[model samples]
Target: MTTTLPRVIGPWMAAAVVVGTVIGSGVFKKAQKVAEFCPESGVALSVWVFCGLLALLGGLTIAEVASRLPKAGGNYAFLRDAYGHWAGFLWGWVDFGIIRTSSIAVLAVMFIESLNNVLLLARLQYPADMEWIGTGLGRWEQVLATLSVIAALTFVNIRGTLIGGGLQMVLTALKVLSLLAILSLPVLILAFSPTSEPQPSASNFAPVWPSDWSQVNWAKFASAYGSAIVAVMWAYHGWLNITPIAEEVKQPQRNIPLALIGGIALLIFLYVGANVAYYTTISRNEMLDLKGTPVSTEFCRRLLGSVGVLVGSLILMTSVLGSLNGNILVAPRLLYAMGDDGLAPAKLRQLHPRFQTPSAAMMVFSGWAMLLVVAVAVAKETSWIDEKKNVFDVLTDYCIVGVAMFETMGVAAIFVLRTRQRELTPLLPYRCPGYPIVPAVYVLILVAVVANMFIGTEQRTEAKVGVGYALVGGLVYALFLRRKEA
Candidate 1:
């Protein structure tokens, strides 16, 4: 019987996991909403920078905790250690049942759905738009694509963290290289391509605060910022995912913190550069008014012509695929941890005798994610859910509040542990630079952001779903998990 997971992933590979998981479809797809939120080019760019900072702070706060308690279930272990078994159990309950699994499902959906744009650009047709059987196979091409990636990744991870981590490093390297190519090729083409039109004026950056603020309802700005941050925060969402697999990271004592911080720092630079690249070429109006689905494709086309579509699509595909693989690789460890603690089904703790990986955990996770993909497709086909909402949007709604809420909870644990230092074993080898203030400010911002998710916009309705999921998790914890513990 397989009794353990190996700690074989080095710092570079671990940082790749953080970068790979965090840099998904959001950056490629979310600029329109960000522009819509900011009311001006500067404001929009500020949102990106601000969200990046917030994410960086979160990385710092979580890093200290992660290094101190390097384990399979990243948040699960930290929460239990700082808060108590009940807090940890509740987080694990919701994370496994909704947060992490739905996140994986959403990434898979984004990957397959985005592929449609690439296929269309090639003048190729797919069965994605057609019905297979009573919506059979549920939008055949996409469902097949989603299932194929999910299955292949599940098997890949079942091979062990090293193989999975290695796969992530390759995918992330390709993604980063591709992104650099996309950024550079455009400027080079603009330099040589004959164009009478001038590049975007520096004046666009004027009114960084938006000159018309007095003309607008200040209250509405909160709502707009709230909405935009939701998307922006989504772009920054995967930064801490590296921590969940900390136990498998070589030198978790040192590497986990480095990966978490280094990854976010890298993302901040990438995100700011991407935004600067887009706005320097495309106007806020043009970006907000884009007819094309992905703002990246259109932005690319402006610079690279028709070839931009292919570039944009490939970039998105690589980004989402890398993120999808990272998700599949790390998310199962949460279940394995829970199972080892006797809080989850014990079977999940079993590793493959030969592969020596969390085979059962990966299979269980991917199987549920496949169901979510199919259910979303079927719901779309039958019009059972909102016509405007797809699986990704619905899942986002179901968990966005919980996502922010939990991040805050995790950060607050830093203080919780400070008081309980005696509770720590060997004690943390590292600590956040500013200590209390770093985590303090981070939690304050999270509270404000989470409040906005509920009180500020039409999005409030969706946040209710997240609340319901939490309540249900609480009930399950009380009824079943608690009883088992007793």
Candidate 2:
């Protein structure tokens, strides 16, 4: 039986996973929320830059731990080695159960949403009219589309990481190039013809600070900024995605660190640039007026007219697909590692003889994600909440709190690992640049986000649900995994 995955992924592919997994639906969709929270162009831009740096700090700190371990489970290994079996198991448990699956579900749902945008822009609809299927939710078509995407990507990843990783590289390039084209659209339009109607202007950035600063309530500003940080966190959510497949990465000590840091740095630039493009082409009031519509769609409409919306929606779909593929490529490695340790089903450790991939784990993860997609859609149709939040919003709100708690602890493991001096023999290949300060700040910020979730009214119930879901993993550990470890 094949017991190991091959180290066929190179530095570029590794970097692509990091960049590709993160640059998903957030930058394209969440800018409107950021603008809503901040309501001032300057403050909104600052939030983007600030959150990007937060991801950078996280990447920097985790890179050191990854370099030392360079194992299959990434942060799973970090937590296990630094803390204990319980800590590691909880990470993997919550990961497979909620965080990772919710991420995939959200991406797949977003992909379908983007497709819907394209159809709406072109004035088309699903031909079959399956509205009778699920209480006429009118979303049966979308749920089916989301399921189809999840199934397709799951099969692609199960073939092998080489195929998956290569696909990721290509998709990453396409998305990055597309974003660059977007940022340059205004310049291109003006250069070709100076008399364009909605030309990009520097004046759009006026009132650099909130105009009514003295009149502003300091408490309200702090609350709004905190909420903005939470919104941007979803955009920068997948920084550690590459680490899970560290064993599959060639020269992991060198490549993993480079991928983590460099990928985040590039993302920082692209995300900030994208926001600049959005704000420069339109006023802050225009962005606010979107009223839940994606700001990018309108930005494209202004620049490319009707054709621009189609192109932009298609680009966003591809971006979501790249992220979905990247997540599928790496996430199952955690399950595979868990199986090897007997923390999960032994079959999960089994690799496909011909392809040498974790087929069982990949299928299980994808299946659960598809179920979530359908369940969320059904719940909305049945009025699970009075407001009727979409699948994307519900999943994101339900998953972020658990993610924040564990990831914060994962970063803090650097301190513990450093103190224990377990793997410092050869002098680490990469140490986090700012050391204690960097990791400390990263941990502190996430802790603040978590606290705000509990204290604030908007997401309190979702936060409670997320925590309860994670604790359910703890219960499983006590009943099943603890005996196996002993």
Candidate 3:
């Protein structure tokens, strides 16, 4: 089997990948979840802003490292350079086995679920007695759709990162533009039609605590803010993925850093803007009391009418699809990297003769993703857990944990790199503005999030399980895999 490396992605396309992956289904869907914790509109907006800052800080640090190293494995490359082969291998293990795959699975499910909602609503409006339209598809149908989505994206990715990267840019732009249009229209309408009273509810624009600071729940404040950071950080997860394609980037030492910081700043603005728009059009109380279903989608329905609902649903579907595409784009590169180093089966290192892509590794990843979809579908059908807790819920839990693990380790790597690698090239092009301070602050915030994760064991049991799985996987790889390599 011959090895075929992908062409370098340029700065603009690299930025697109970061934006595309970071701004996916989570932004549209997770607003309701944020609302659950921070009911006050101002608080929610603040949370979004703060999360953006954290993302910015993390991105800056990653940009510095990526600029310096400019490798394909991203975190894996960072860890290997900073620490040792074992640390890098652990990052790869989790990324390939859990983080990327689970994320793709969850997004794929959301894509199907969002589409289902749109179809059901269309049926309800036009054909009053369309039973099949509203009815949930059987397990097999879901598995098929999930596989179909993965397979289609997998084929695109196998063509090479150039095509994949280009498609991601277009889809990302469309998704962002659609969201902004959706958000802006209602505000414009309300401004023009002053007589139209938007529904009243909790103070959407008021501060959660009075200016005096007397009413603050210092304890709950700490906890709520910490937990909110966890959610926000999760939403801001993909800033570091740019490093994986660093080798493909033109003038990576200069462009990778710029792309990382610029991409994250753009995402922050969009998230904050979108949330503010949501509050401006809909009241905080309505957002908070949005029961039985998610509020973000409902908010879209109320703002746009029937057409709005379909458009919002389509936007969300596209968002998830982009995220899935990103996961597929980056994850296989890890397998290829690992195989190159003889950490995994070398056959995975094989590149296609014609396509110049990792054909073997791509197939393996697609098959694994399909299997996960089947396992999840079967689990849901069989009531493996209470029907109340669906497979979607379980997988989301697993993904969060996996992501948290990577984040915690990745941030720690920032420190490790500073201390261990003295001989690396002089920092060039971009540097984290605050440097030691910014990275240090990010590490502290991450620690606080992990502490909060432990505190809310009941709510975040899945997160705990995810951590356990990561630790176990790391240990196993270190003992069996790493030792053999050594």
Q: What would the per-residue lDDT of candidate 1 be over residues 98-207, giving only the tens digit for each residue?
A: 77778888888778766766666655333455333222223668888888889998988887678888889999998878666655654665577646244444554544
Flag clash pairs in model 2: none
Full ranking by TM-score? 2, 1, 3
Candidate 2 to truth, TM: 0.94
Per-residue lDDT for 308-399 in model 2, tens only? 77888899999999999999888888888888888878999899988999999899888988888888878777888556444556667666
Runs in model 3 lying further than 4 Å from the true structure: 1-4, 124-136, 195-203, 210-212, 288-294, 387-394, 420-427
Candidate 2 RMSD computed on C-alpha atoms after optimal superposition onto the true structure: 3.2
Q: lDDT per residue, candidate 3, 1-486, as tens digits?
A: 457465568878888888888877667756666666675667777888998998887887887777667776788777777777777787777777667777777778778877777787777767866666757665577668888988999999888778888899998888778667755766676677555545422456665544766877777867776666666665787877787777678888778877888888888888887877777656666665665344557666776566767767777888878877887887787777778877779998888888778778888877877877777777766778676544544565566566666665676676777666555535455655776898888878777677777786423777667667678877887677876445
Q: TM per model? A: 0.92, 0.94, 0.91
**Global lDDT scores for all candidate models:** 0.79, 0.84, 0.73
lDDT of 1 at 75: 87
Identify the candidate with maximal lDDT.
2
Candidate 1 Cα deviation (angstroms), residue 301? 1.4
Tell me which residue pairs clash in candidate 3. 8-248, 9-248, 202-285
Candidate 2 local distance difference test against the native? 0.84
